[model samples]
Target: MNDLIPLISSSINDTLASLSHFYAEIILAAGFLLVILADLFLSRRFTQLCFLISLSTLLLLGVQSVILLNTKTVFLFGGMLKLDHTSILFKLLFCFSSLLFAIFIRYNSPLQKHVKGTGDLFAILLATLLGMNLLAMSMNLLMVYISIEMVSLGSYLMVSYISADKAQTESAMKYALFGAVCSAIMLYGISLLYGFTGTLNFNDPAFINALKNVSGLSSGVAISLVFIGVAFKLSIAPLHFWAPDVYEGAPTPVTAFLSTAPKIAGFAILIGLLPVFQSEGGQTNTQYFDFNVILAVLATASMLIGNFTAIWQNNVKRMLAYSSIGHTGFMLMALFAFQGSGFQALIFYMAVYIVMNMAAFLIVDEIEEQTGILLIDEYKGMGKSNAMLMTTFVIVLVSLTGLPPTVGFTAKFLVFSSAFEAYRNTDSAVILIMIITAAISTLVSLFYYFKIPLNAFLRNSQIQVMAPGNSPKAYLGLLLAILLLVLIVFPSVIVKLI
Candidate 1:
């Protein structure tokens, strides 16, 4: 009896311990189940039940995150997952952006009228956010692979969610095929890594220590191969072939979500992976510098391609798609500058990026809702009429172009400073080139970014459409944009927390 009592107490304590560390995910997962059930039952009676469920869940998760504010602990079945400051920061961002995304979908999307599976869309988004939260905290290869697939599958489905048109269906098909191929390649790479290192845990001291014995070429290949999966998520240059078509075809809200949240989470995973794979002693046993060189080259290519090609784009969403690729290059700069203190920079940059991109897309959807127009040229002369929308758009675009008095500028400055610090410390030639190229690209971006306002306020067109609507959603986005500017002035609030 005495032995059994001790056993019972220990078991109960262990269960409580596990549950406590997972509060944020617990809130999100519970919300997911509630959303699924709500869609099953209430969606027939109330049109907004699923959206409300998703929003409620996100709100609960945010509250849970605040509750667990400073507690950093690893939880789950074993040492396979972690919830630290870094992971918590990303999770908070994911939840916050998801909240905004839900609003965007609710207000501007044609999904409510056109799509049959919106309930499914919300459920899938919840599940994908779960995957992203896990991806941020994963300490094992198995979790990494699972989380990646979860996000990929969710993305593929979202791309196809409104497949009522040929272009939409074709975009979905391309995204599906491309995503599957990348996952397969990534799986093979993970297998190679597991075989070489004989362990699946990324955070285990033993696993990293064992990696030292592996051949440099083998390690580099394995590491780069693993990043292929992540690169697919971020849509950096080489892996970016599908971005434009998919962005143009998908529901604009999904495009907005895809362009921001999951990509940032993917970069978080890359940061987690890179430190373990860094070669010691500068011995250079491997020919490739793994992700650093690959990402540097990709950033340079992305900057050139994303900028020059965007200059030719007439469609607003498609233009933003390429612009997102360009932003990927800037984010990569943060990755390169990732020495100590760079992690904070990366997190802050991601937060600002989310706010900036979501706000930009919100405006896109708002304009589309009011005027039924989608082209940059269609925006001509509206800057004079849609004063509020255009002013917000201009502020957001200026941030994207990395100008002052916006969070975008601060984020860019943070990353550039980190890169400069890296160069100062190491004098690496690659760092030098990345800095110069990023500086030049920042200038090039102003040309295309200004085109929207230039056409709206400066250029002439017969695009005399109805005035923009007085939407609560648009105002909400504007409020968030204002908060972003506030953060830009006082970045330390977020930076200190990160």
Candidate 2:
């Protein structure tokens, strides 16, 4: 009993020390509650009050992230979390995405016109952003599970929150049900790992060595279960059926957020969990399955499935949904190939991906508002009426295609070059197969991505189209598109920042 006193004192001390590094998250927590209160009382008088507070909170959080970029790494909450450069960068990206989400909510015609107020969405987004920040920093299996459930729960609510039609209600139910199954699988896996290692702190050397002592098949299955759960959240193949239906059915702004921020958080979790599986002392790590080989296969399969299926998609959002799955696979390839500069390339691609994806959805929302074009067939010659907007859309598609003079090109180039470097370093056939698959997937994606421009410009439309109204979302999307172009010209800007 006496020994417990010293341990308690040390635990308290570490937590207190961690608080200084936690100010940004503190502000976020405070703002989340503050928004709920503001919505309850002030929303009647000032409709946008909650929105304003959410933005301010995200703004404060973003500033804190930038300032903490150079801080030395440290464990928080008794090693449940780890504050590091990578986590800080991910936080900054998340804050930026939430800001865009808020702006999108403000200007989105469908959301704005809905009977349900946008105030609650602002609050939910703040809460979800907080979860993402924690997920990015989580170093323990316990924290990882908690943060993931938090984010998943928030997403489930968001998708169902403004259910206006049967499709939305159906999508919501599917997302929640599917997510619940994955979460259970993951929890069982965690239980197995804890039973094997007797510690939830994945960073602890004990976790690694204990797994090493475990039977090969046992450790392999346990870890693979955990991987499947995380992959499900990222909408990777064989677990990705829900994404397209949800994206097509959910509000456009919600669809955009779903595709970008949550996937990034999933990558962070995968990155942290990866080091635990790698073998030490230059020995064969056969205690676990061939982790990299499986990852490469998943990447190759995802790229092919996502791209090839996207070619047949009619709904614009559904097409992007499949494309996102392909992108997830491509990014996973980067994760598999991560060595030295490969990490940097992955980060750069993610940063660029956020911009291009958000811009695409925003522009689509604008076109939907004015022309009500939901299908690829609907875009026929509408570019003739909305030339500038369609031109912006074309440029965004160019970037998404990783063509020259767009930041998307730069992002893809870095990833491919780094992937080749990984291949040269290891001479692994798995990496070679994925590299080929990625190249082919990119070409396949062109057919779907260009379908927008081709139908918008080359095909003729008989129906008259009006120009989009003065929309804040459209302008913001345009700014993002231009930023992509600017970043390509100075590729080092975002690359070095990351």
Candidate 3:
């Protein structure tokens, strides 16, 4: 009992020291509580009151994050998490996405009119943003599991916030159940790893040494089990079953957030795991399990499956959901060169992706709100009355397809260049194959993405269209679309950050 006192005292000291480095996350925690309190106590008097608070919280959180970015790389919370440039970048992205979602909810009449009120939705957003921020910084296996579960729980609530229909309720249930299974599998893997290594700190040198001492087959099995949860969040194939239905059933803003922020946070974990995958230490027998090959195979399968499946989707949200899976595969290619410019490429790509998704979903929601159109075919001849929105939509789609004049193309090019550099340095056949597959998938995507422009302009309308000219949401979407083109012209804006 006397000896335990020393350990407890040391833990307290460590926590105290860590708090100075944890201002952004502290703000996130406080923001979450304030939002809930405001919703409970003050929402009845002022309906949009919670919305104002949420947006201000997000804005303040973003400023706090920028201030923290200068902090040197240091482990916090007794080494449960790390403060680093990459993690800060991921946090900024999360905040930006959540900010966009707040405005999206503001513009969404159906959600604003919901019986359950939208205040709770903002609370969930804050909670989920907190989880994602933690996810980006987690350095310990235990922290990783807790953060993932945190995000998953908030996401479940966001999906069923309205529950205006059976589909939304069912989507929420499916997400919860599937998430539970993935969490269990990942926990089992974490247990096996802890048993083998006797350490939960993955960044600890001893952890890799221990894995190196273990049999190759055991190590591979444990690693695969843990990555299943990550794959689920990134919407990689096989683990991608929940995405299409969930995205389709979710509010458009929620869909945009799911497809971008959490997925980018998932990649942050992958970035942290880079050392374990490198084959530099011959003693570690890192070559025995080729994550490059495993990831390449997964990337290929995701690309083909996502693109082909998207081609058959009539609903815009479901199609974007599937294409997001494909984009996950494409972004997975960036990790092949994780130590090089790949991290830069990944961050840039993620930023551009957030913009592209916000634009796409904004346009889709506007069309639906104005005309009750959810199908791609139903978009016919919209360009005539809604020229500005349609032009923005076309630009967004073109960017999504990785074509010229949009930042999406620049993002894809950066990733490709980074992957190519890795291949040139290592001469890995898997890298070459992944690149080829990514190119093919991009071409395949064009067929589906172009369907928007084709139906909107080239094809004539068969049904009467409601007036679809004026909308604040459409203007916001246009700004995002134009941002894509501007960034492409000045690619250095993102590149310099890298």
Candidate 4:
């Protein structure tokens, strides 16, 4: 008891010192509280005040994150959280995506009309953003599970917050149940790993040595179980069954947030875990099991399943949900093939993806608002009526398909080049297979992505669709699409930032 008193005092002092490095997260936490209070107290008179506060909070948090970009890596909370350039970049990304999501929710009629109000939704976003920030920086298994559940619970609440119909409620239930199961499996896996290593820090030398001494089959099973939670968040391969229904049923803004921020956060967590599969000298440590082959197989399966299944979907949101899965596979390839420049390439690809996806969904929401049509077939003959909007949508889709004169092409080129470089260095057949699968998936994506333009321009529809108003959503989509073109010509802009 005497010894424990000093230890606890020292620990508290260390934590207080660590708080200096955690200002951005602190601000976000405070913002979450303030937003909730405002929602409860002032929402009756100032309906849009919550939206304004949410946007401001995200903007300020983004600025705070950017300021920390050049700071040295700092491990806080006794190595539970790691603050580095990569984590800062990811945090900024989440903040930016959350900003856009706030705007999207403000403009969304369905969400605005909900009885519960959007203020709670903003609070949920802040919570999820905090979770993702923690996820990006987590180094301890306990921190990982806590951060993941933070994001998952916030996501579940966001989906069900404005449940106006049966579909929305059903989607929430499915997401919550599946997420709970995955979390449980992940917790069990963590316990197994802890039992094996007697430690939870993956970066610890003792943990690696312990894992190396375990049976390959045992370690593999434990690792695979842990990956189930990540796969559920990434919507990769067989674990992606919940995505389509959730995306199709949730509010468009919620779907936008779900597709961009959380998915990237999953990648952030995966990147943090990459060291588990590597040695101190940066070589693949295959003593326990070959993660390369497992990841390669998962990537291939996700690409094939997501892209091929997308072709048959009539609903645009469902189709994009599948496409998000394919993108996850591609990002997984980037992680697997990470070499000298792979990290930069992966971050750039993710940034471009967020831009393209948000723009695409914004356009989809606009079209849905104007015409009350959600089916791709319903877009027939509407091109001539909404020429500018349709043109922007086509450009966004073209970017999504990784075509020329767009940032998507540049992003894909960087990832492919990184993979090729890794293949050359390691002579790994799995990398080669992943590259081939990615190329094929890109081509497969074209058929569905082009369907939007084809239905709008080529096919003739009997129903008279009204032209979309000059709303903020349309302008936001146009701005994002234009940014894609700018990024293509100035790829160095993002590259330098990284």
Candidate 5:
């Protein structure tokens, strides 16, 4: 009893001391509460108040995350969470993406015109942001499950919040059911992992040691089950079926948020789990099935499936959804090939990807609003009417295609170069296959991505339309497009930060 008292007291002291490092999350939680209260009590009088609060909260969180970037790595909450450069980097990414989402939601007409207004959406955004933040920093299996569920529930709510039609409701239902199944599988896997290892901390030596001694078949099953949930979140192949439906059905702003922030958080979780396949000497764990090979196959499959499938998509949102899956493939390759400074490459690619995707979606949403066109064929003759917007869209698409003189090119180069380096170092055929698959997928993506421009510029519309005038969304997207060009010229800016 005496020993128990001392241990409990020490834990309390440690948790209290951890509070300082946890201030940003505390602020996010507080902001979420405040937004809820505002929505309840003040929303009638102040239409834009929730949006303001949400944006401010995200901006503040971004600033705090940047400040924390300088701090050395530390474990908090008795090792349930980690504060490190990687976590801080991803937290900042989520913060920036959420901030942009707030802006995107503010200017979205459908969400604004909904009976419930955008206040609830803002609250949901904060909740989702909180989940992503937790997901990035989580260091334990329990934290992993809780954080993923937090993000998933918030996502389900966001999708269903403004269900204006059957499609939206259907998408939400599919997402919930699919996500529930994945979560159940993941929980079962975690249970089996705990049963085998008697520990939930993947970073713990005991966990790896147990895997080393356990039957390869059992460990492989457990790992594959856990990855099923991660793959769903990432929208990788074989589990990517829900992405197109959800992306097409959800509001464009919500889709934008879904494609960027949650995907990045998924990568953060994958990065956290990578150590399980690594040894203290920084070599692959030969005793287990080579996770790199498995990831490489997944990456290759995602790229091939995503890019090839996108070619047949006429709906712009669905195409981008598949493109996102293709990008996931590239990121998985980066993860498989991770070496010293390779993380920098991954972060850089992710940061650029966020900018490019948000900009593309912003343009898509604006075009959809102005012309009520969602299909590629409908984009015909829009170039002459909405020249500036289409031009920006072209630039963003070019970036997405990873063409030169754009940040996307630089980002892709870094990832591919890192993979090549890994191939050279380890002589792994899987790494080489990933590089080839990435190249082929990039080529495949060009066909669909170019369809946007080809239809907009080359074809003539059946009906004439007035030009789209300047709007905040258009300007925001243009600014992002210009930022991409700037990044190409000065790639070091983001590189140095990472």
Candidate 6:
């Protein structure tokens, strides 16, 4: 009994030590609390207080993350959490995304016209950021479940906040209900995994080693079941039914944030989990499951479905949503090819994706604000009157289509090349399929992405147009678009970092 007491005390001390490594996340949580309080008491007096607080909080968090970049450390609160480079990268991305989101909300939230409590929106965003950061570090299945639900709940609230129409409300309702069901299923999967392995840490080397020893069917069910929640977050094909509707119905900025940040987090979690499936005694351990083939098939399906479905979307935001899914497929391809240098390529693609999507949505919101139009056809003759904005929009769309001399093209090339390398090394049929499918989908994407330029430049409209409003924020967004344009030519700027 005395020996057990000392062991218990030692475990407690180790846990506390690990918690210190996550000081950045702790600070973020505190910021979230402070934002809520300031929103309630200080927002009325200081118009921009909530925004300032949120932005400052994320900025500081970003700094904190950068400080820990080269450190490799993991701490488990009794085997529930793990922190390391992977989690740090995820948190950094979340911080950058949150900052962009705040800028987006300030400039053009769809709810701005009708909503009174944007302060709540910022707070929810912070809360979601907190969850995603935790998700990157989660090793336990229960921790994974909790972190995912936390982010999902925050996302639903953000979507429903100050919704202007029945459609938006309906979208939020669908999201909440669907997300709840997915969470419940994932919880069950976690329970099964815990029961099978008697441990919850997916990243714990020993835990995963134990899990692999389980019955073949049990391991497959456990892994596939856990992937359900991630697939939902990623908007992958089978679980992607909610994406277009949610993206179309949510405010444009929210749509942009939703499409990018959470997807990146999900990918990080996937990266953390994939190596665990590389069972010992060769890759043919189980007849019913081949992890690589499953991911490859999902990638193929996501690319095909996302690109083809996008071809049918007239609403700009909806098209971007499907496009985001297609991008997810591309990222999955990277996931397949992931090794030492793959991290660089993945970060490069995600950064460029965020810039492109944010800029595209900003333009959507700007056009809507000026012309009160949301359809692609409504963009007719916009090129002539809104020449500057349309020019910026064309650049962004071209990048999205992955044309030459664009950052998107560079990102795709790296991913494709890496996959090709993986194929050469292994000659895996699955890798070949993924590469070919992704290439074809890129071509398919070109058809719809070009529609933006076609409508703006070639099509004509009878309606007269007015000058764009004098908003500096719009110019800033255009400047951001220009930055992406520059990134295409100067890809090394971001590529060298990761």
| lDDT of candidate 1 over 1-498, digit per residue (tens) | 776886787767766777768767777778889888988888889989899889888888888776666885666656678777778888889888898888887886578786474788889899999999999889899999999888888888888888888988999999999989998999999999888778898777777666666777777787778878878988988899899999998888999999988898888788778766564225545454555666678888887788778989999999999989988877787766576657777788888888888998888888888787799878888877788888888888988898988888888888888878877877878778988888888898899999998988897666466684568767976887787778777888887667
Cα lDDT of model 5 by residue, 1-498, tens digit = 676876998899999989989999999999999999999999999989999898888888988988888789899989999998889999999999998999999999998999988888888888888888999998899999999999999999999988889999999999999999999999998899889999888778888888767777677788888888888899998999999999999999999999999999899998888776433223243445667777788889999999999999999999999999999999887775576647888999999999999999999999889878899988989899989999999999999999987899999998888888788888988778889989999998999999999999999977997856767999999999999999899998888778
lDDT score of model 2?
A: 0.88
TM-score of each: 0.94, 0.98, 0.97, 0.97, 0.97, 0.95
Query: How much does candidate 5 score in TM-score?
Result: 0.97
lDDT for 323 in candidate 5 is 94
Query: If the candidates were sorted by their lDDT against the true structure, best first, what order would they fall in?
Result: 5, 4, 2, 3, 1, 6
Per-residue CA lDDT of candidate 6, range 1-498, in tens?
676876888888887877788688788788889889998898778867888888888888888888888786766677677777767877887787778889888877455554485788888998899889888888777777788888998899988886688989999999989988887877777788788778766766777677777767777887788778778888898999899999988888788899889888888777776665554225345677777788889989999999999999899998998998899988888776588456777888888888888888888888888888889878888888888888888888888888866677888888888788778877999889889998899999989998988998998889877756636546766877888878877887775546
| C-alpha positional error of residue 104 in candidate 5 after TM-score superposition, expressed in Å | 0.3
Report the alpha-carbon TM-score of model 4 versus the true structure: 0.97
Write model 2 residue lDDT over 1-498, tens digit each, in one string. 997887998888888999988998899999999999998889889988988999899999988888889888998898889999999999988888888888998888777776768888888999999899999999899889999998999998899988989989999999999999999999999999999999999999888888887777788888888987899878888888999999998889999999999999999899988976553323465634777777788888899999999999999999999999999998887775675777898899888889999999999888888778889998998888988788889889999989988988888888898888889888999899999999999999999999999999999978776775648777898899899889888987776666
Which regions of candidate 5 deviate over 4 angstroms?
Answer: 277-288
Model 2: clashing residue pairs? none
Question: How do the residues 280-355 of candidate 4 rate in per-residue lDDT, one tens digit apiece?
Answer: 2222445456777778889989999999999999999999999999998988877755757788889999999999
lDDT of 1 at 368: 85
166 Cα displacement, candidate 6 (Å): 1.1
- Candidate with the larger TM-score of 3 and 6: 3
lDDT of 5 at 368: 87
Q: Which stretches of candidate 2 lie over 4 Å from their true place?
A: 279-288
RMSD (CA, Å), each prediction? 3.1, 1.4, 1.6, 1.8, 1.8, 1.9
lDDT over C-alpha atoms for residue 17 of model 4: 87
